[model samples]
Each structure stands twice: as C-alpha cells, then as structure tokens.
Target: MPFFLRTMMKVLRVPKRTIFIVVIAFVLGSASIAYAIEPTTFHTWFNALYWVMTTMATVGYGDYFAKTVRGKIFTLFIYVFGIGLLSLVIGKIIDLLSTVYKHWEAGKLNFHGKDHIILINWSKKAQYAIEEILSFSPSSHIVVIDESDKHPVTDRQEIHFISGDPSSEEILEKAMLKQAKAVIIFADTRIDEPALADGKTLLIASSIERLHPAIHTTVEITQEKNTKNFRHVHVNDFVLSYDAVSRLAVRAALQQGSSEIINQLIRREVGDDIYEIPVRPEWKTYKDAFQGALEYGATLLSDRGDLGINRKLNDPIPEDARLFVVSDEQTYRRLLAI
Candidate 1:
C-alpha cells in the first residue's frame, strides 16, 4: 500500500464515533464529486451515491457508470481507497461486537437501567429466582453479582451479570444497586456453617441498606435467629431457607397436599399466585377491598403484613394499607386496570 493509504487505514482504527463520521463524510463527498464531474451520465445525486456505494462495496451492479475520462479516473480513485475504508469499517464492527460479547460473558459490563432486580451470589436458588421473576414479568430486568469469573446465566437477555465481591460497595454500584427495584442477597451455600453464611449475607445487606435505604431488599439466611440482625439494617424481608422447608414439610405431613398449594401460590408457573393491588378511593374497609377483588375474580389475601383481613372485615382500611390478592395473570391485569 502507498504511504497515504496506510495512514488513512490507521486513521480508520480510531474511536468508533470518529470512524463513523469519517465514513459518512467520505460517502457524501465521493457522491458529490461524481455528480459534479459526470452530470450527463449520473443524472441525480442518488444515482452518483448508488454508484459510489456499489463500487466501495465491490457489488458493481453495473446499472450506473462514469461516461467521461475524468469520471473514470475518479471512479478508479474511489475503487482503491473507498473499498479499503469500507473493509476497515466492516472489520471494526466485527471487532466491536466480539469485545462486547466477551465483556458480557465475563460479567464485566455495568448495568444502567432503573427498576431492575439485583441478585447477589449465584446458586441453584438464584437460578430459580431468575426463572420465577421472568415468569412473573417477562420484561423485568435482573442483575446478578457474584465472585465467579463467568456469568451463570448468559442465554437470557433480561438477566445481566456482574462478577465481583457482593459486600464491596464498588461492586454494588457497578450493579447499579441504588437504582434497583429490589436486591436479593442469597446465602453462599459453599460455606458450611449457618452462622458464617448468615454473616456474609448480613454484610451484603448492610452495604445495600447504606447505599440505598429506600430500595426494597430481601435476604436469604440459613438460621432464623439471624433475622433480628437484619432489622438493624432495615432489610425489607427474609427468606428462612432451612426453617421454611422443615415447617412446610411438617405442614404437608399434617395436611395432605398443603405444600403443593403453597407452591402454586409462590411460583408464577402455577395457579392463583399472590399479587399486590393499588388502593382505590372506593374502598373504605377490608370488606370493600375484599368484595371488589372478588368481583374481579380475585380474593383479597391480606393488608401489608397482616394476614387476618378476614377477622377485620368491618374495620376501616388504614390510609397506608397495601392490599394483596390471589389471582391469575388475567384477573390481576383487570384489577390493575381498575
């Protein structure tokens, strides 16, 4: 290659924005030159542009051609330089896509979306949580943070992963924790002792609370006794893994098929899952909310943490009431619409 051509090729490898602008300018300038030099043959700007593009791309459709000697020489100039520039652009695009994919697989990319759910630590339980979240809301964005080198789930577009220590504030920020809708810190099952696992979870929970106090946070702990420790950090909810399984097993043994019913309610893949509904102006008491939900083919389950809404059917609804109902997806949508 000539010195000028080599220098031009080097310039093409600059930042993407600059290369993009240069490509645009080159296409426009080449088209204008062709149109000015061969007005009789290249009748319009579009024709000249088409010819220049085809020549650069090496497509050479042969629909348009330069009739004059000067136009032919100019076309040759474009054939040599323009084709090289176009090749560089194509190569650059491929390189960029490869770089992005590597970053994604390595969990080195940062998530900037708001209202996304963040799951710290990757485990079988976290995998199930991702599935449930997707089933509940297919379009929901989820971010996974862990110390592992590779992302656990790369097939899902909605689930993003970041590789880092969960307790580190810097890693949490990379996951965009402050803008997240909720953060679920799962216990590191690799650790054998319950106290050690809960200790790790508590550290991560405290970091999240300090970074974004208002954001809802749910944590899984091995021991139920450590639940009180989370209260100091104002963690929103706790999932007692070991105790919950044991209690559910005992309940199932006492009442046949009771565990199955609970499973259906908790998992979105099954029937009549729990859902939250907005408080309407018409609702004055638990009776009003219950009847309204029933009319929409749903049953009001509870108000906030109070599961005894059945006992307080006649009592006035509190102003800060958050009503939960049991319904399928269609019924839930109808209730939300109202």
Candidate 2:
C-alpha cells in the first residue's frame, strides 16, 4: 500500500518522469516477452512489436499466431502481464490529468489568457465586479488572482485563476499582465482591518504599474486615508468604496431618500449610467459643449484630462479634454456625435 501511494505521488508530481518510466518498461517488457515467440508467431523484432502493440491494445489482429507449444504458453503470460501493465500505465495517465485539473481549478496552475481583464484579490466585490463586466460582455476573458486557499468564483471555465499574491511579478506574469486589456485590483475585504486591506491593494496596483507602466489599472480603495497614496502609482481609476459609502450614509441620515437615490444612480439596472467622451469638433468651445450637453439630454458632470481638470466650463474645451456625462447608453452615444 505504501509503495503504491508513493508511486501515485510520483506519477502525479512528475508526470514526465512517470511517462518515461512507463515507456521504457513497456519496450523492455514487451521485447523480452514477445521476442521468445518471434520465431513462431512474428518473424522479426518489428513484427514482434506490432503483435505486442495490437494484443496489448486488445485489438487482436489474426495476422500473427503462435505455432509452437512453448510459444502458446509464453503468449498466455504476454496477454496477462503485458495488457495489465499497459492498462495500469494508461490509468495512471488519466489519474494524473484529473489531479492536474483539480489543481488548476484551485488556481495552482499558471495563467495563459491574453487580451483579458485581470481581477486582483478575491472578495465578494471581486466576484460582483467580474459578474457585472461579464453581464455586458460575457465573452470577455477574465483572470482572477488572490492569496486565498480556494477560489470564491467557480464553475466558470471562462474565468481563469491564479491563486497567489498579486504583487509577485512571477504570479502577475502568469496572468499575462502585460497583455491584459485592463486590471482591477480590489481591496481584500476579508481582512478585518481596513488599512491593511487597502495597503495590499495599493501594493498590488504599484506592482502592476511597475510590471507594465502603460497598462491601464483600476483599484478599489477601502480606506479614505489611502486615497492620495495611490496617486503615486498613476492608477487610471479609483473606486473609493469606503469614502463613497460613508458619504452616502451621512447623506441618508441627514436627508430623505438620499441613499436610495444614490444607489439607484449607480445600480446596473438604473435608468442611466455615467460615461465619458472626448470633446467633439462642434463642442470645442465651453459654451458649445455646455449647450450640446443640454440639447442631447445628457447631464454634464465635468470636463477633465489626464493632467488637469476644468470644472469651470468658462474657457474653451481643449482638443484633449474629456467630458463626463450621465445619461442612458443610447443618449450617451448620440451626445458624443452631437
């Protein structure tokens, strides 16, 4: 039993070695056993190998036959021992594949996805975020990595997983970090301490930035205090979950239906969503942009760019200026053209 367990472990751990051993054993065992009957049944080593392969595979072609009494006795042992060993080796391969699959599902395997979205850190938030993205684009490739023992999301073959610290370059590389369309790093909300959780998220964002400086990244910050710290990483966007919730809670306590209204605004099923578009040719001037927003039924939120924000709307909109507008998907697209 102990020897069997050790062999199983070796086969599972080092399948290449097990395959080499099995192939070598099959050649030597078949050559020794079948060569004895070669003089009667098979004329040469090549014919002996053909007979052994066919017989062991249980495809008994009648082209070869044992003529002598000694050959017949040896044939009995060949059928029993050769077929049994070959079956055991084939069974080992199947078992190894199953074991590898389980490991892969558990996120022990390296990632191979490209042009996919990567979600760093596992949490209820991560799961929801992934689901939200997939709801709109179900075919979008997504890879999730976390330090947790087991993946929170499963039964999703489309969602590849890497179970490890996201800050590790080795682990990040497995997810095809450089080739990813975008990465969203969520604070590990499982950790009781909010600071520690946000800190980890910050580190993961910085690590991703270092891995590929131009890779677009979005990170969820759980602590209001750490908001400024993430700016150093040059993250493209921040979720600011803790601060947003706290402000919403304060508004709800002071006013009527504030929380419900805020929730409705951000909810996926809500009437409208926030979208951003670059300033258009007709909307080059601030007054034109402002009038265009009103004409198109889009609520103009802000005019911004990578290096600066122009909330005043008094000056002319620059060529690189982007406008944040709140409107339905259909209206938003029309507003961009108008």
How does each model score on TM-score? Answer: 0.88, 0.69
- Encode model 2's per-residue lDDT on 1-338: one tens digit a residue: 99999976765565556665876677666766677655655767778778777777789888986667777776777788677667767777788799888887788887776789999887788888887788657899999998876756678888888888899999999899988999998878678888898888888888999999888899888776787899888999888887787788899999978888677667656667777866777665676766777788887767654223335556777666677877787887786665
**TM-score of model number 2:** 0.69
Off by over 4 Å in 2: 1-86, 253-258, 277-283, 286-301, 304-316, 330-338
Which tens-of-lDDT digit does each residue in 84-167 have in candidate 1? 879978988998999999999999999989999999889999999999999888899999999999989878878898999998
lDDT for residue 315 in candidate 2, whole number 0-100: 73
Q: List the lowest-lDDT window of 10 residues for candidate 1.
A: 8-17
Query: By TM-score, how accurate is candidate 1?
Result: 0.88
Model 1 CA deviation exceeding 4 Å by range: 1-29, 43-46
Instruction: For each candidate in the order shown, give its overall lDDT on alpha carbons.
Output: 0.91, 0.78
Best candidate (score: lDDT): 1
